[model samples]
Target: MPNSTTPSSSQALEAVLARVDAGLDASLERLYALLRIRSISTDPAYAPECQRAADWLVGELSGLGFAAQARPTPGHPVVVAHGPDQAGPHVLFYAHYDVQPVDPLELWHSDPFEPQLRTDANGRQIIVARGASDDKGQMLTFIEACRAFKAATGGLPLKISLMLEGEEESGGVNLPPFMQANRDELAQADIALVCDTDMWDRQTPSITTMLRGLVADEIEITAAARDLHSGMFGNAARNPNQVLAEIIASLRAPDGSVTLPGFYDDVAELSPELKAQWQGLGFDEKQFLADAGLSLPAGEQGRSVLEMLWSRPTCEINGMIGGYTGEGFKTVIPAKASAKISFRLVSGMDPDKIRAAFRKHVEALVPSDCSVRFIPHGGSPAITVPADGDYLRKALSGLSAEWGKPAVITGSGGSIPVAGDFKRILGLDTLLIGFAHVDDQIHSPNEKYDLDSFHRGIRSWVHVLASLAE
Candidate 1:
């Protein structure tokens, strides 16, 4: 039997932690250097910054004993790198280097790019900048972890393949095609490790187990051949805006549950195990609401805040536009009004069926004088990572050993398209192990990643790799 001793390992970990502590300054320096690059993928002006970020990653990967390269996609370049060993189960590590734009820059405590290390009023020293927490901070957690392994062990504890993309924030336009084209090279991994999710709380680590599915579409309603002044047409013409509002309003009831025909037909309710797990989390809804600047649960009347966010499905009108206003509003009954609507579906929900149901609902609602058309976007089904899977047990063991506490297997409220894509195309299960926190403020101004998360994240990855080998 394998020995159950940890004294030697504990010594090694302490020694590694010491090296990590010593290297914190240099790590922050590297992070600041990376943050300095304006890798805003959405803005065409920052294309060079994107390339520079990829180049920087390539250099780091090469320096860390990997054959790394910056390969161009239709959009910004993707940073690819791999370990020398091919004997172990291949694991693909993922993180996005590109960050959102730091607009309305006045809200920041300091310059967005010109990062500074400062202690907040609470005495927590944080790295402040635009990309500090969003992704550059999050991505560096994995990279810096690899750095520590190399520093202490002369090599990584396991073989790693990195697929750091640039277009995650902007809907991952090129990632699918990029992965598809490089299927032979990318899909060889036994599993994928996505480190772009949030922790349960600041102090508690989490393993994301489920991601809600998404189906988006725009509905255009036409009531007249052309716009007509409300004064001239008064009581004679149908106002497309009103019609649109009624149709949109009809999709939900007072309780906030989606009222679309058959919208809940395929929704899977939370299992007893899941319910018990979430209940055991001890998450205070009041505190969570306070953070979000709200007091009431606005989703479903009978569900917990965690349920509303994680397990329950929702339908929301992303945007709506009708009529016109330059300086003052024009009292015109517009010929057409559109509402961009989307659905967050649970497992067992079929996107096609939901689409059909929505179309039928709209068709039934619109009168003969009014016409409606639907534009379909790509839809994906929800994914549930088996909590009882062998990999999860091993992964939790690894995380527990590192964090000195049980890792929370949580559910992600948002959609991660790649996870579903991997399930469909590669058949590889994703282990959502990330070190991000709620305050990281991804996609918001003044995004920042925590320093401790960065240092500990690397060692955590090392432990996970070790666990996987067993």
Candidate 2:
């Protein structure tokens, strides 16, 4: 008879990793099956498809011994699954089954729903489909890791819960409500794991430790009762376009810092350790600007490009409209001028306060005769994971071991509102780890996930879970 005793951590990890490697083909097959589902959640036409995706997930999780069910919401359903009660740290894994619409379908080399494994010009195997790298492929990495654990050890080392929602692409209007209603059940987990982000590069893995928040608004300035011929009004009338332009220009100082009053009041300085780590990333600022067809950095004088992107706040004019935007020239000043503006906020800053400050700044800049109207476009605060957390260090070590390179800690210039929602609602800090690359082209046609990324992503999760359990 074979000796039957508890396997050491290294033995268990090795077994699970071998299982992951052996099951790579099956894992790809399962991911391909998921990508075949046209689960576009934004459009009303794909409602049934969204439901089908949710149902498929429930079936898969239930088959894996989870108490999985497709729970109803005001919009699409959320698949909530729970594993058998265990003794280790419980983790809630979050990912969306829904994908962005595959519009401009002619641009795709193949059908977006029919995923294919093909080699790129650089000779790397990639899986091509709409949601290949966005979430479908990424989400399956965790599930496949669990499968390997089960196959190798007959059970998982820790407790697990899965939250796969179908409305993330459509603004996720109902997700907060759904979470609130089930807060007691969902909050039981020790931490949340999200897999809807990207890696720093092809060779280096990354954990997004901070995500900047957003505050967006639209402003309309009306200076005249009706459109007037410029010749007739000539240099005498108050021009809303000129007024709007001046206000936009005044938003930034010559040093490229936002000039709003008290804009930096709540902003925190980056720690010395984090600054050192980011400096070691060897980011080519010149090359970065060259790729964007620019010659110089445009934000925050004396700050590195990464620091400006990931730490500092920003004010940008997204769009502007006043008069005579057509092909031909019209010598008239329109009665109203409008502009869309947005602010990217860092940690410690409140979105509501930022929005209010922006409105106040614009109001002060408006001409006495001109009237200004504001339209709110919603806001969310920034999210930051603690640098010294035990879970974070363990996860990083796991990734480093799997990838054969030291994993990096990076910050995102964009926001994932769900991370904030997780903290606010469930009182859980989320670890935003994903294996997608920058060129994955998610939300665009011809989206793909590197075949190696998918395979090693499973093993990476296995390592992470084992390290956490230890």
Q: Count the backbone clashes (under 3 Å) in each candidate.
A: 4, 0
Q: Residue-wise lDDT of candidate 2 within 176-220, one digit each (tens)?
A: 999999999999999899998888888899999899999999999
lDDT of each: 0.82, 0.91
lDDT for predicted candidate 1 compared with the true structure: 0.82
lDDT tens per residue, model 1, 141-232: 77886787678766665568899998887778898888888888888888888888877776678889889998898999998899999999
Off by over 4 Å in 2: 1-7
Clashes of 1: 4
What TM-score number comes out for model 2? 0.97
- What TM-score does prediction 1 earn? 0.92
TM per prediction: 0.92, 0.97
Worst 10 residues of 1 by lDDT: 1-10
